[model samples]
Target: MKKLTRLEKYHMNKVSQRSNGKVVAITPEAMEIEQRAIEREKRGHYRVAARLWLQCMDVASGEVERARIAIRRQQCITWSNHTRQGEYSGIGCRGVVYD
Candidate 1:
């Protein structure tokens, strides 16, 4: 099993706390899409992860869920190294501009 990141653990804790540790129904399709997005994020493919996060958000069940996914998408976008041509790359978002 992949070890959970700090952010993932934080989300799990808050979600469990919110519902007394009970899980609501999750659509398998949405879960699958979420897994793919997470994998992309772990591989440093923030652009792809952002797209998958948007898809996951579309299938999310409630406002809170959608909001969480939107947060993830935004994080990806921030780290995506936005370019003048309106594209993203794996370049780390540390103020390095690639031409």
Candidate 2:
């Protein structure tokens, strides 16, 4: 079997946690991170975007950013819980939540 490339590995890492029969919300913070990334790319600030993106993951700080990240992480957990419970109620829950 061919080994996964770096890009594929990155994609897989992001999705792996969600593949275990659970939902994951993208959250406003994550969306903001993504938006910033896009803006950075547009302004040719790819390195800055990359740094910000990494900071958005699992660990981040700054009172404001920390709060935002915590809220988003909670949203992701809530989403997964809702999805699991929905399975019992027969409601089809699909996709990430970001608002």
| Cα lDDT computed for each candidate against the true fold | 0.71, 0.49
- CA error at residue 39 for candidate 1, angstroms: 0.7
Off by over 4 Å in 2: 1-25, 59-99
Off by over 4 Å in 1: 1-26, 82-99
Candidate RMSDs in Å, in order, are 12.0, 18.2
Residues forming the 10-long window of minimal summed lDDT in candidate 2: 16-25
- Residue 15, model 2, lDDT: 42
Give the candidate number with the greatest lDDT: 1
Q: Given candidate 2, what's the lDDT at residue 91?
A: 44
Summarize candidate 1's per-residue lDDT along 1-99 as a digit string, tens digits.
Answer: 467799976665466323432222255667788888878988888999999988887887656666567777888999887533554555776566767
